[model samples]
Target: MSSEIRQLEPKQLWNKFADLNAVPRPSKKEERVIKFMKDFGVGLGLETIEDEVGNVIIKKPATLGMEDRKTIVMQSHLDMVHQKNNDTVFDFDTQGIDMYVDGDWVRANGTTLGADNGLGVATIMAILECTDIVHPAIEALFTIDEETGMTGAMGLKGGLLNGEILLNLDTEEDDEIGVGCAGGIDVTAIRSYDQEETPESKIGYKIVVKGLQGGHSGMQIHEGLGNANKIMNRLLFDGFENFGLRISEIDGGSLRNAVPRESNAIVAIDAIQEEAFILEINDLANDIKTEYKTMEPDMVIEVSETETPDQIMDLGVQEGLTRAIYAALNGVYRMSADIPNLVETSNNIARVIVKDGHVKIGCLTRSSVETSKWDLANMLRATFELTGCEVEFGGDYPGWKPNMDSDILKVMVPLYKNLNNGETPHVAACHAGLECGILGTNYPEMDMISFGPNIKGAHSPDERAQISSAQKYWTYVLEILKNIPKK
Candidate 1:
């Protein structure tokens, strides 16, 4: 099936994508990909260095007369978020992504296509391995663990790269030139609870919240797609209120970055209210579906009877857990006053698990403004603390502040216009977390910009990349490389 992906036009880029995806490069688990990259750089006989924290840097001298141009950094993370559908059986650790050609797009079979950064990685790899492309000195940077925490970027030391400008090929929309991006922090809440013996009168059932269109929590946070954890909590809250339902175990969502798509809970309820519970839940599910019909047309909320559990969460803890999740924020918090149609601050209640006398809740908060980032974080911390959960904040990274006066922007804007029937590209900041910000700390003077092909449903199983857009973007990359400013 991956052979189909290799056949896409611009074989240089698609072939590299297929090769990269053939290796398992999940975040925080990139040993194989790291080796692959090192071998690639060495194979080309270029100056290659694998930093202490696992970032690979491959440098190539300027080709032909382009030596007069400024050196540039081409960066994309080597890692991809590992996500799959509930009904799909795939091992992200051992097997390569099974991809197929779908109309004008390329997609994985029931799994994330890894186009977010893989496409970017492929683009750079194509150029690095090329013999005819006219470009300035290239510094190919491949970072690890970008999907989960960005630890690779944080751990990178200074004085390593000689480039004066950076061209980040990680932006999703081909028509947009990204000048800025949001920073993020991880919010985790944990606590202990006592499980009580299930009442003799209680019977068990399974509640599944699926079919929601989950996506990149940051890029699509403003789209109003449903969050599975929030939807599941709503169902549990209503059931407990009406039927004195007791929770035995609940597991919702997967990664903290991808908006949750599926959630399932095991619960026990008083048998006397079984008939009423089914009717009430079905009606509520229908109401929820109606509320999101346009955004999540395929959303399905179902409850089915299941084997009984031996224990249920303490009534007090159960009540607190539901209330805290209900109170927590899960979508866009503020729009940028500085930029039109930009999400300035937001939160994704990304994951939730309540089981075995323990509770864990994970969230990712993003904001371009430093103060606003913590403001929303404290909001989540306070909300969960109300439920006696000790919350911790980690993986803090800074946002990329937009430079309207950027020299690279000036070069890219007019070039993009000439490339597209004189149509101007959208010059703006995005809500998604890009490594441009983190990479800037050590090289403050480096002018940076990001752009890429159109990738939809990123961070979710429905992820796909456009074939035509990739060709268009490929042309842009070639032109940009030829036009790097003189040193």
Candidate 2:
């Protein structure tokens, strides 16, 4: 290998990470990254197959002594969730992620680090390139659009893989091995009413809610992060009680799975009470910030001056929309009564927007149990119906059921324990969705286990990967590959 190849020891993973980050590979826009991998595979003379949907599977022949060992498929998603702050100007489609080093941590500049799956991608790249590592016949399966739709995994066929055992390299924690994950469904509610002309004397002020730390709805839902959309609605609800205000426009939040960071409402306030309204709004924001100081320290409301704004929605529509959002779910709804630390059912009021004469609210509901998920979905439907709004639901995916008796776990438990000096790995199920559950339904008999290095702030601009954990996970993965027994 040339010096430019960048050796991928955990300490040196940053270099390889830098190389990958230099390429733009947002979800469904991975032609360059796909071609890069293909070229690398061809250069190494490895048997590589690039599927129609940009999913790539590279086959590496087993070492001389381990040729008889069984094959194990190493799986990871190719694409990443593209998100950035409102003030960040970088474009995901054209710009490569700008990354920087922070001691043992590597993070992107004002954008998601892509370390959630980038580490997995780089690990496979190094594994296939290394000549010294011991391994059986290995298949590095890189699927596409996992963050948004999981389209690549959904297109998989039964016989596509030659391996009966799969090792998913997408888990976030280094010390824990994920055995299962919650399933999710995306639901949208839309309310539309005729616009009304602004009253001649009604004053218009832009009520803005800003500076909240919106995070991944799944991972950070339990963390008590403030949803800006929910906060904005609260202000509107309170303002209506004091002074009659017409909601001209209401918009906030982003990503179906991320807590809304900012919200803005353009409302028509009574001109006589405008000064008091501004003071009250600021006071309310301050009080909310103090209340959620630990969760959202920077939370604030800015009542701004604006030119004569066009009408957004009529009073009746505004009232119905406000009521619907108030009744809508925002935080932890139900906890697992059975499991000690499990979140059985929950929903995030992820995104709310006013566009094209419609008020659209995007909600994400998750649960380990199918019944609970459906119940939450039904609740959302009922809420929309109460407002006489049309509701739509789709993008449902299955949850991975934990297999305490998973066949692969039975074999690998002792191996992992022995490798780590008898310190057993933590076994747990995640609240977030994993490909394992979807793949489980696709391949009923396939045995799967997920493990990865420590990654923080996944699905957010502040995401970073721990350097030392990468080395540990790489070494452990190699051990598993070398010890795969014959089927």
Candidate 3:
């Protein structure tokens, strides 16, 4: 965290953001942040409750002359996706984010900025602290583990809050008002295999793929960005088929929600094919870079000599695994029929690991349509199952269906236009997984809408927040709070 960011306009929100970012809040490991929020609420002398599942709820009575307005629920998840560049040396669990000002944006040094929901969390904190900001009764709900599985939202029990309207401040685009979002499920395939001794004449080499602009798997799926796992498998498949390559180890990608940016593998090939192998692999690597020249200018692939391993995977299993990976899907599966240019279904083959005689392939599949989601999940299951792996599905959550006539949508559309010099906001649905959908499972009657500042390259080290947009978004938040409909 930097003092420079705390000096940004709207110090109320930026200051809170700096304070919050100073504490480590990685997804599924939010114990420190949970306690921080509870302490903040307790310090303010507000009624705060920590739910059984680790969600924090702070209640504030209506401001003067606004008691008749409906109590509004302001929600933002507490945890953030943890991602860093391969060479960055920092512990996410132990240290605060190292952020700096980069012209119009605030970015971290080779690590994710946690702007996806941290900014939203800061907005509520500012409101809860400000005395002059007008508003109705407030229910500030901070859920944890949104990036991994939305476990906090899923575990929320019904009848916890009495608010009639919900405002989710997790949308990434400042000019867009989110009315719905895609649902998601986690798909993992696992198996163990036999290891065999390497041949006497085999030579070892390390293949590295990195420098790709990885991003949010769901929101950026249609952008055609390079997936390192997919690219690595392509190169491996080529080596095995043409040069008699044998795989000893592979490790790629990190979180299931982030597009894989790098992959590294150890492989062995017959000694006689050394010259031809180097030439072909370099040529193939160049071909991949050229193919993604426009979308991934920074993409890089490297191959180097390394010590040969004593053992490698059995030939039969290696063949099956490579083929299975090639057959699996990595990007968009279907486009929305109702909304123009909206992605209806997609998959991100996020993690691939082959080590210690065990193989694990992790994926996150998302879709707005229920049937289409399963259609893609089963398709992936079949592909891995064919390779003698057992597949499991978990973290199932439903999509937030668009409510074109939502009361909050009607209120914010014109408010946004007025704030932006008559520029009407883009009212639409998104492909990202938002907690609004999971929260709806327990609160179906609450009308909801999501909007936030301009945050780009989320779930990756390139993640940053635009300074100007945060100011604009903060103004809109104040207006919406003051204009809540009467109960």
Candidate 4:
């Protein structure tokens, strides 16, 4: 056993986490992690089961003197969003996450730490394996493919979960209990174009945007971070007018739910204007960066030489892509008038790709209200249609509606306040999607509330969880577990 894998508090739980991290468990590729979890439960003599969709459930009998307590379900997703820096070469399917301790916090080197839900998993595993902590009959529910789609949660049938109370351990802010979350839908646009060889008189230049703090679109949308794709498109449109260049290829952003931190484009320009064009772009980059420096101080725009200057997009194709991109919706569409701090609707132009004569654009639209979601989708679809491109809306999950008088909230808020020295924890709705939304529809009677430690930069490389907050969260969670009411 590696020293890094040595057990921490709740050895069985952290051991399972360390062991699970050793295996690759990116979304849709969580078989090894799933199997390992089930086997771990079996070795501990607990009842374990796997659903057809790869979700896992482990049931542990009530601890001594707790059989009379109501059964509580602890839930978190097993799959993680696989992301890494451009300089890193680790593979998600083959490489274990390189984790290390920084003072009091634990994080992965150059990648997502997976502490998002892994902590929840470890906590649940600890409770089940201890045969010690006095608590209710517990069910540890692990769902799969939650990052890309809530397939596991969506497919859950009635009676799968026997627990009447659920504690969701996926919120980022430690002191804020997530009572609701925005529903979301994926929107994609595609346009087919004929290719044409570039005229020999043209020059090629690579336009690059770098050094922005891209974060989870839902969590950080209101943070004022720059979207690389949007900024790049703005520059490209400006360049085309001045230099009469044809875009050969443009690509940016990694995930549909993350803010784009960097982007690059290949353009063919008139050989005579190449030098002047590069200079102009460099200047524009700095100007744009200055404009957004309060939020994106690290932003850099560079126009550099490329190996070949011969490749070029067809004139009409270039126009279609540029127009569609310029017109596509990006940034917060609406702010909540009711909730002072809430963002009611927003869209992130999350990904852009050019391949096989097709340039595809991907965006994720979010809204707490169903009408707002559809309204944003309609705006995107209309923008694409205006550019003569085809657009499609992916299947969307419903939002978790906030119930102020919810039974779960009634129980958790008091526990939270008492644990924090009479500090009343904030009650807020998340713009991000949570399993509660899907689980509500699947199991009508289930009541859910999400709470967790203070985790920053979720879904991005800068992600980190606060040490003090974790201890507080654990303390509060334990209290909630012991006091949940029975029917």
Clashing pairs in 3: none
Off by over 4 Å in 4: 1-16
Clashes of 1: 0
Residue by residue across 1-487, what tens digits does model 4's lDDT show? 2245444443454565676678788888899989978997898898899998999999987777778877888999988878787667888889887887666666778888777777777777777777557788888899998888889899887787889878888998887998899899999988877777778887778888987888889989988899999999989898998989778888899888889988988887788997888788878887898899999887888887775545566677778778888887788899887777898899999998864478889999999989999999999999887877789999598999887887878988888878778889899998988999899997777778898887787787777656666767777877887787865
Tell me the TM-score of model 1. Answer: 0.99
**Model 3 reaches what TM-score against the true structure?**
0.99
| Model 2 weakest lDDT span, ten residues long | 1-10
Per-residue error for 142 in candidate 3, Å, reads 0.3
Q: How high is each candidate's TM-score?
A: 0.99, 0.94, 0.99, 0.96
lDDT of 1 by residue, 1-487 (tens): 8778788889999999999999998898899999999999999999999999999999999999998999999999999998998899999999899999989999999999999899999999999999999999999999999999998888888899889999998999999999999999999999999999998899999999999889999999999999999999999999999988889989999998999999999999989999999999999999999999999999999899999999999999999999999999999999999899999999999999988999999999999998999999999999999889999999999999999999889999999999999999999999999998998998899999999999999999999999999999999999999998999
Model 4 lowest lDDT segment of ten? 1-10
> After TM-score superposition, what is the CA distance of residue 401 in candidate 3 from its true location, in Å?
0.6
lDDT (tens digit, per residue) of candidate 2 on 1-487: 1123244355335565666777788887989888888887888999989877788889998888988877888898878878887689999888878776667776777889888788888777777888888888888898887877677887776667788788898989888888888898988888778887777777778888877777777767898888888889988988887787677777798677777888888888878888988888788877888889997887778888775456757667778888889999877778877666778788989888875478888899988888999999999889978887889988788888888987767766777788789989888887787788887776888788988899988887878887777877877887788778777
Better of 2 and 4 by TM-score: 4
RMSD of 4: 1.8
Task: Output candidate 1 Cα RMSD.
Answer: 0.8
Q: Write the per-residue lDDT of candidate 3 for residues 250-292, one digit (tens) a residue.
A: 9999999999999999999999999999999999999999999
Query: What is the Cα-based lDDT of residue 167 in candidate 3?
Result: 94
Q: Model 1: runs farther than 4 Å from truth?
A: none
